[model samples]
Target: MASPRFLLLFTTLSLTVSSAISGSVVEDLANLQPPSDFNTTIMKNCQHNPSLRYCNSSSMDLKEIFKFTIVASHLCNESKNPNCVHSFDHIDLRNRPKMAPLYLSYSFFWKYCPLTVLSIDLSNISLKGSFPKEVICCDQIQALDLSLNGLTGEFPIESFAPLTNLTFLNLSYNYFSESKISDSQFFKRFNDSSFIHSGILPSDRNYTIKAILLLVGFPISVILMAVCFGWLCFQRPDYLPRMFQRKHKFTPSMLRAATNGFSRKNQMVRSEGVEIYKGTLRDSTQVRIEIYRGCISREKRKEFVEECKVLVELCHKNLVQVLGWCRTRNQRAIVTEWTDGETIEMWLSGSAPPWKQRLKILIGVVDGMRYLQENWPEVVYDLRINSVLLADNHEPILSRFQVGDQYSNNKKIHKFGIFLLEIITNRRSQEFERGEAGLIEHVRDNYPENLHKVIDARMKLPENMFDQAKHGIELGLMCTDQSISKHPSLNQISHMINKVYESCLELAPQNHKRSHGDGVVGKDSSNGESRL
Candidate 1:
């Protein structure tokens, strides 16, 4: 509204004043300095920490200095952030040349930026290394927003411990393994989300510990398994499969020592390729060692061992017990429990025993055959008078355990008839001339008329047993019949003998835990001959 001359003069004055003000703002910003109480530690430590070493140079830029001033003023009492609790507004603090008044206002904050920056919102800035060391150095921080930094390592509890005034801390989305801060340092205002992934749980640290344990424990487990396998193979071959199940487990060297190296003096009997020797064990138990001299191949040795397995299982009072077995490169040997007294064949060579004693021997022989045929009918044995060994009490024991499947029960029973005749008649079957009938045929042809004449002249039978003797002679003839079907089964023979001899034979304990019977016919009741 004034005249043109007046308006032009006012505009010139205004331009001069504005230029002076703009010059003052530029001068003030250029010469800005932090106050005495400022946290210079943030810059000093950040300069030394590797991650924030660039902070020192970045802080020197005027534009960044302007941004830093805004950050400082955001927490001041004079100008607090409008939305500090949830999110922060983006601030464009680039160095543009227009606003001199805005520069003067920020210059005032640049004066106190170090002291007044109690709050920092550097969230989502991709800061690293267990959070920026710059923030930890600014220990006066109260509300820190370092979320989404992807920081890792041991949690900085010691560094955070000094930040006693910290209240609104957001360290979410950071991985940390340890937290040993004192309870006093964990103030009540801290929300659960403040440390959402921050403390007291496993991170990558457990993987390292597991790797070390595996390296040490794996070798120890393998060593233990090897030791157990070795023990099982050596000490317990029976528990293994049938192919690996060994027999002749006694070493030949041990048996040699027990037999005085097979001295001729120790030899008890010898025939064909077999020999029996008297041996004494280390435990002072007597053993009769029988050896096969020519059998040497693995097949032959296998046959010998297979025979031993059967012998070991056929335990009974009347059967001679196989104590152990052994084999060498060219020999197989079996050890048996040593029984005293000679075979029944040798006994008859001397003066004939009383008829009662001979009858007892006959009954025991029947019991032994009964057990053998009933349990192992397919088994083979030499059922001859010569095979009957006498115990100390003259109880008859069959000498041969089964070795193969060659002899049949019917054939063995027919031979048993010949054995009974030898015992009663006291005559050797081989002594009869070949042109004449043998003892079996002789006894079969003659009847009760020849029974007393064929009976041993030295034997004197009791009057009550005369009829029993007659029946026994008739039974022997029946056993020798030519037809195999005519032979009595061992069970029938046992029952017939038990019926005829029940009044005379008493029971006595036999082999332990064997099922042949509860006991054997060990005692003769007729005359105090309790150990027949």
Candidate 2:
């Protein structure tokens, strides 16, 4: 007849009372048995029969987080000096620092440092910002759990390579920016849930099986592939797309001739070991030949071809078109249509245009990026100003479409938000050797109150558009979150941009009416309405 809570409480009290009563009866028997017995002995044991209770020579290690909290050292034998591990192979400070009245703040608990064969648990201890560097110090640690904390930063495999004996690891619920355990074989032993919400995915492809299949079926596949290729050329060419046709594959010799022996005058370094050379093909079509300083392995040659096909096939008005590709054993290059337009970065470097012009260009970039999100399989990483080009016609051309939810957060959207700030403020992040700290950090520290300071003096956002710009700045701040899951969707971003832009459209007509002297166009100060 009792409620569930009352019944549960009643059962717990009854069990406790029964156990206490049983323990006292055994204690009574042990008192009549051995007078030299240990205190609180549960079993009826003679002092000589130490097997039934705790003993120094026992092989079993009693593990209780509260009780076993320190590391101890002692002589191995009477003949040997100290510096020997007499402690258990566990260093669990799991939620202990705050509850250290019993054991004086860990003692560091690593006295003789017998941490080699260790099982550590430091979860739920409010570890924020980054994981403690001291973890890698125990090179042979077998078990570690750092879950339910704010530990972040690069938790890559190589960083944990010293922990060769690490059979168990848990790093869930952290904000790590560069943990690449996903799609890796080395981390396959750990549970996938341990990395859930942290964005570390499990290895889907078994390379061992893949290698075996490649070895056994490669020769047969090659012949079958040729037949399929021929069949596609004769019939269903859609199966083997025109982008994959041999005509787009330019030889190294042709590319070298086009680039005038990789002339420095025509060359621009995109990144380390990568050069973009402006060249004219035999057909007189100008091209941007970007070559990497490496050789393509035979295994990756087919992948390279597939990559080239994808690059050339993605045709969008805003996207820079990849015309063809150049490949050889010692050389590899992608040939995209050459553009006379400058990057958004270059425009800002000199003198950025009015707010209207910059906003229009960003809108084009948004549309291009949206299309890429729908079609491109790759995750877009580097969506910077230098990558977003403006053509001769002043229309935005997203030259670097390398390849998000929400209106939720990821790097591409975050960078796009950063791009918005860049355009609005006429200021680039410290990334361009032009600011203190990150642009996002600067904005977060002082925004809305210091909105005037952040706005570009040169931009002169129309008095009517000022409110819209502020709204956009707020949207950009949200989108730049480190957790991409927090970012708003492309549709949401597009709407905000359009909303601001629509205000521009509305003001344009009013401005034209005023310019035409439409009967003394002015605001009625008392009524706060337009007067004409």
Candidate 3:
């Protein structure tokens, strides 16, 4: 053949041209436009019955970007599509080297498609190189399932910042050598479901490191190199107010004493993410101190403080009061007024609270929820029965205001109303095993003639209260309507309850009457005898 240099040049040019052609093919596949008839066919055959035709259509061009159009909420696994059991609408190949070309094609589709969920279970997928820094642009993605992937790199905090709407992020079973993310930052942005596969230790290493640096390195560095800086700061103390200062005023010794030297016996309650203890201040005011032991970042601590301030400012006779808070080197604690009453579960399951008292408890809880929804600024407390705390008077107080960012969307107002309905009806929203038939189905399935059978059996529903209960039930059903637009606001709900309450008052007999022997009462009017 030709000269050695010429031959080498020819081979290199050939390989470059071949690679370009291959890349072009993948790009074309990703950018393929849907056929004009595609929408018509999808709407006719799959729109209403997405579960049936989503991933089962053999005729559809599954390799092309247009294939993602088949995804719909109804197409979720509950539909029982044999071919599409594990079928996903989007596959992310971020930081994947061997799959770089595939990732490029995927990026094309990801940018074009309206995907809500992305499943990239690349757990064992060999990623020989470091993670791609530019792969953080998938902003609309709600679920990022990347567990079990061979991702050998430091935890990517910046990569996750763009995924603000992510509800589920599974990074378990991956090779992460260093822990750089804070627990508070983690919990504030993502829920517990976000880290299902990742092996997370109980103690947050990130927070510990920051605490050490603040307590040791920063102080020494300031003293050694910034003498004038310290003097100027000390002289112009008015520049920083005492309340606004970042000083660690609460000592570990004081906290230990307040918590009875960390006695397990004194622990009032312990949940997965938090712990509560009965504490006494110097004033001897009893306080229920709750320590949030979850992962949260320093940057997000200010937001958490603002949220806590809003909660503390809330004033209502039926609501629990937040007394004060303590922020130390290692932790954050919220102190609230103590309540000694048993939980609703205890009163209903136990033998202490009587039937009439139980009815009053229910009324008190509903009233508390009503007040919060109406009065609280930019916050809605979806109080579950698990969060209901009882006072010494046996009155229920709604507590624990934890909800995802979905609560802030105006579109979800109607959905919140439906949740309230579930509380009143005492039924779970997702009653069906495979799929949720919703609150309406649950109510219709369990309607009772006696009203007491459907209501809390622990309480006696007044005979004259049947109509009012029905009104309440009807309001609940209306709020939980399938269409989100149809549900009433909390203000509307308050008006409805008030109107019903007024009607009940007008219907009540003026004078009390009793039956001859059983002590049961009935109103003896000229018109007819009404049961009390």
Candidate 4:
């Protein structure tokens, strides 16, 4: 004979116990390790939940889900099921801030399952705290989305590097500053529309118009302008010729003092198109003066000067600053800001800085390319590694725009992808060693692995970073596919690079150490001692 109150409490307790017991598919799974098959039971029970939209339990294996977004309600693992594995690719854990702890726990699951793509688009979730570095361990992850979250910290470039498999990444709609990772043409293939709020049209739309303009309007304009200008010049030879003949005169004495009298030893750099000499004015300001000869026609020389003038008006961290230019008999000289660092190629060959410095250099290259592609639409052209030069601050600035075809067509975007792969792998595009006939045959015979070997040997890359690099190489291969139609757009390529970078960052190690060494050149030992 129990009292009424005690009877009611007992019944309620019984009902709660029964409900907890009945709700879980697995009664005892707490001790099992990850990659467990018990995930099938949980999936089966929670399949109807809206949040688990991307996950399917019919296959009885978590690996079935690939490149999907998962949003589920009432996701639970019984304390007994320790071996459960949750494998959802490109998951969006939005509208569920209360599930933060569960999301954090899934990162460990990511390590065990090695997802190839993951997106935690927690937009409007107002999530806090820094991302755990362990997320970088997902070596297979190729894409990551953590955008629209309240994440705070420096741009986690190092963390993202490990996710070499990543091809699309988004950290947009956050409160980040210059510490934000610099852009690369590699990232141009991906979607960047959500990052900046400028109210501009999508890149795809702009690219279409530019392509039409370049392919149709530009050629016509060039021919029409050339004819009109040529006719006008012929009629008014005195006026135009006099303007061109106004020689920028400099005294022989002044030239000698500016360049130490053209001493060969004083020349800082020599290239096919230009020779750069280090100089100092009477005021003691150091300068770099580049001399160009034999490349431009007399008529084209004026155009070149105008182009330089336009370039001088443009100022950016990625572009080298031009101080002034002069045209003398049989020669044209342009003064520019001197960069302290060496070329990226030199650094890759172990001729200059250490590996950590090289990573920073890569970031700089990305920044410069982003600037060029984003700002100077008319000059958008194919770029290569040789165009990337390290500055005095070891920052990378892009030059040598004169080379490569400039076309507004989206097809040119693939070239940027190839360059991105080159940077990560530290391999020359033309220099790749092929099997049988040549490099192409070799690459065709053994892709991915052969490509992986192209990575710089100076530093040990994390697994995820290596995977991201591998994915990038694959993307490059796709871009260079014999069938041009298979190639992706620059926006797509950018998205891919961003994804890889984000995945790498998520899985990067916590105790990883990087070297910081002096910027001076070492003796050119036959064994990796030359200055890059």
Candidate 5:
């Protein structure tokens, strides 16, 4: 409405004001001050390095500085000196534009203060190459943000074990769709948001159906599925297979009563914001209730529900059963059948079991895995001793922990091999001879003849059982082979194990034949002995 001259003046003023505001923001970021409690001693050491141009401690925490703006003066090149890393407790450069090469960042990180960076944010940096193992060198890292990059090759997820303090992680929108992570708990703190654009994370049911239709040429089944899914979404939302379901609606009062007012004394395992409580139902039935704390995001809640739905649908004696799920005012809860028996790891820590017992447990785990691989869309991404719960009868039940297809079946086979070696050597995968990287390599290096040295000293094997142990070791070695093509299928392994068991039974004394369950033909039940 103003005159042309006045309008022109106003437009010019607006542009000038915007430029000034932007410059102010940049200057403020450049002159950011470090916190009072920041380790100045370390800062002095870093300041000694001349190559680092933008090394400054900051009071700004992770949430405050979600993203960083790079100015023309900003310089973060590779440094040879180890003291040239950023002195700040948190460094967030997410969605950076034309940023410095990742290798430069890595070199800087590796050279100076690699372990000092507590939090990192480098998403959308157009990062190329496989995720470097150097990132794992940040032993004190709590929150890592490496989403939306051009990262390629298999992600060495096992390397993350050293970063025990990691709390928040984001690896979405990257080339991690096909990459495998062996630990299920590693993904528990994160959600589908972290795994977006990756098949390893759960997807929307509607989108998944559409994807299937697209692949199968839009068949009639697609239409049928769409109609059914629509109906289920509106009428029976709980029946849908996808995440976000309410299995049982128990009141907060009922839960509190079951868990003795959620007492700390009833706590089983506490990690992150999740608390597991041992409870007893009104009918005196024992149960383990997992309560997700208030800090859990909606995405994490959905993932928990989705995982529970999968567990509920799976019916296997060797797999733990999911009883129900509940949501209250502040927390989400999942109820699972409680087993009083010790974990396989705990059992192994005490005394080495006989070959027959160990083999039986191994077969149970393999059977559960076979069932899931055949019936479910997921695989056991994290299979280990802690996940194997030994029942009162010494039956091994696989815990409910699944990951997407990013990890191949070959990886699971490799883990099975490791499990075999653990049983044979009576040593953990983490514990190995000096200079050895992994138990697999150690076993392969001294096999067939020198295996006796690594074999459990507690084992007083009968003559016939030695052959069974040797066969197991051979199978283990085959599964652990570096090449995926060389590994045997679960079916083949199952058949071989059956053959071994039958041969061992045939060698038992004829008088030992009895109506023993679990394929064990023996007369003795008391004191766990074979009576002839």
Candidate 6:
């Protein structure tokens, strides 16, 4: 057995080797194809269609790590002007036997390609159901053509509002329920062509008199059926959940009083153009209020309400619960359960936390993140040290009140990697020397060989725990890996982190023995063997 001091490092190294071997075996068993292979398959599938020649693998670098960009805009259009978009030329997968449903194949294709798909021209692919929330995470998507598809449910114009870069969208010939689309500036960019086939009759189906007679539909009976169907669809459920309904929806005046008339004394954070104030409700419930600065515009207010509806539905122990919201003609604020602990960023600015505390926080973060991915289809764009609040008991809670841009698990994984590095190094990426670049970039560049250099200077990791810390760093790298296929699932990551923690627990006995001046015994080293 290795000495207790080196056991963690040895275990980490061994686990890495085992993981690689097992990963390859799993990949083979699942018959999963690499990104390059998937790209080639896509190209071959589109070969017969001349318009889809742009689907060529050369247009995208599937092997490029950590960067996403579209290189060929002209492939979709013949116009000489670079900005001109005639049509999103490559997404027509209609009648293709090998091509899977969009939802089933979404993550597979998304991760394989280096470029964020700018224009999706899926005009004839018989897609159905509510808009696939997955596609919205592609922040760069500019044009979407879902015309002639069988899409249903409420028109998700509000969901698309965050895609600031979106320029053109066509949802014609699809089954979409009527909703207020013109209320937002985001929807205003889309014209009448976007709503062509309300998916309702006469564009939908024409019921003939003969067919109606065969179904025993008299004029009065037909009218009653139509009325019943409309009522059923409209009364199915509340857009906002019943649990979120509150009788004590605080008015702006009440909030003002609770927050000391919006005084600076109540302010908790005033960064990134966001102001958060700490306050107590009349019932003495401690709360945090996030106030959005400019007066709520008519369009913006509608979007906020819709977003709140979704936010209120989420419930997780690791997440800061959103209690209620206040919106008046002049102001908008979202209220959440308050915490006495300082921001993780603030805490990190001091001495490094104990290894156990750090591990606990990391586990909490992973749990919260996994919940977000499973429940919320959107990207966690606001994950950062400032967003993580530590309680008096040092428990970590992830918080987000406002709806922002679309982000995906891939982006979250990358940010989580940076967060891990920050916790370990006690330095912000922006604070790095100009030549060194971001934290992940610098660490990745120096990893395995010079990793010790990146550890927080103040953190004297016990020799036994050093390998555990290194193991965590490796997990961070895996999370931030450029190759999407290599990235561990949320559950896998959570398990790995917990395993490292278990190893720490296993070392406790040996450390105690050494501290008591008990000469190291073979049994002591054996007791220190990693439980993982």
Q: Candidate 3: what lDDT? A: 0.52
Candidates ranked by TM-score, best first? 6, 2, 1, 5, 3, 4
Question: lDDT by residue for model 4 over 1-532, one digit each (tens)?
Answer: 1122221112222232234433322231232122333345335434434233234223534432310111111121222222213322344555566654455554424433323234344455665666545556554566665566766655555566566667766665555433322444434556654343211223434645565677899889999988877764543222345564223233334445778887887797798977888877545666677777665577776766766665565467877776656654567776666666766677666663333454455455556556666666545433666666677677777655442236544445555555555565566767744411243344455575565456554546544455555675577667656566556755666566666655555554331332124433345477753331
RMSD (CA, Å), each prediction: 20.4, 30.5, 32.2, 36.6, 33.9, 37.0
Runs of candidate 1 with Cα error greater than 4 angstroms are 1-248, 435-437, 503-532
Candidate 1 per-residue lDDT, tens place, 1-532, comes to 1122211112222233233333344453455444432335335434444243224453444344433433333322123335322222222221222331253245333332343246766566555565445455555567777676667777655567777777787776666556554542553467555665554333324534454566787898899877866664565443457576455366665677778888998898899999999988666878899888884788877877777877877777778888778767778888888998788888877757766677778778888777777777655777777778988888888877766657677677777777777777777778877511477667765677767777776655443455566777777777777765768877787777667665434211222222255333245678754231
* Segments of candidate 4 deviating more than 4 angstroms: 1-256, 269-274, 294-298, 351-363, 380-382, 403-414, 430-441, 449-452, 486-492, 511-532
List candidate 3 segments past 4 Å from native.
1-252, 351-375, 380-382, 402-440, 447-453, 457-462, 499-532
Candidate 6 Cα outliers beyond 4 Å, as residue runs: 1-248, 271-273, 379-381, 433-437, 483-485, 516-532
TM-score attained by model 4: 0.43
Give a tens-digit lDDT track for model 3, residues 1-532. Answer: 1122221112222232233333344453455445555445444444433433233445654334243332211122222333222333445444444644344334533333333334433444454344534335546566665565556666666667777777766665555545544634765665444444343424445545555677799889878757755543443322345664333233344456777886897698888878888876545777677887655677666666666667777677678886555554457777678888766655455564433353455467657666765666465564544567878777678665532343643434444444444444454555555322455665656664544545543333455555566666666566556655556765666566666655555554432332234534456577576654
**lDDT for every model?**
0.61, 0.61, 0.52, 0.51, 0.63, 0.62
Q: Please list the residue runs of candidate 5 whose C-alpha ends up more than 4 Å from where it truly belongs after superposition.
A: 1-252, 294-296, 328-330, 379-381, 433-437, 510-532
Worst lDDT run of 10 residues, candidate 6, spans 65-74
Candidate 5 at 12: error in angstroms?
Answer: 99
- Residue lDDT tens for model 2, 1-532: 1122221112222233233333332242233221222222222221333432123223423222111221121111111322122223554556644532222232232321333336767777767675575556556678888887776766666667677788888876777764454537765767654564453443323433454577788988999999987775644342355586456677665677788888888787768768889998766899998887777688787777777777778878888888877666776788889999888889877865876777788788888878877877462424677778889888888775332122223666777888888887767786644352378777776688887788776665444656667877888888776654567888778887877787787886775565566445458699976555
> What is the alpha-carbon lDDT for the whole of candidate 4?
0.51
Using lDDT as the measure, the top candidate is 5
Question: How high is the lDDT of residue 426 in model 2?
Answer: 69
**How does each model score on TM-score?**
0.48, 0.49, 0.44, 0.43, 0.47, 0.49
TM-score of predicted structure 5: 0.47
Candidate 3 structure, TM-score to reference: 0.44
> By summed lDDT, which 10 consecutive residues of candidate 5 come out lowest?
64-73
- How many clashes (backbone atoms < 3 Å, residues ≥3 apart in a chain or on different chains) does model 2 have? 11
Q: Candidate 6 on 1-532: residue-level lDDT in tens? A: 1232221112222232233332332242244223434455334434533222134445554332111111122112221223212222233343432332622343433433223246655566667787766566555677766777778887666677677877787776777875653454554576544555554233223323344464676777888977865553333212225564343255675677778888999997897647889997766888999887677679988887777766777688788888777777767788888888888999888757777778888898899888877777653435678779898777788887456546666667777887887787776877766521467777777787887787775655656677787887888777777766656778888998899888878886766666565333333356665321
lDDT of 5: 0.63
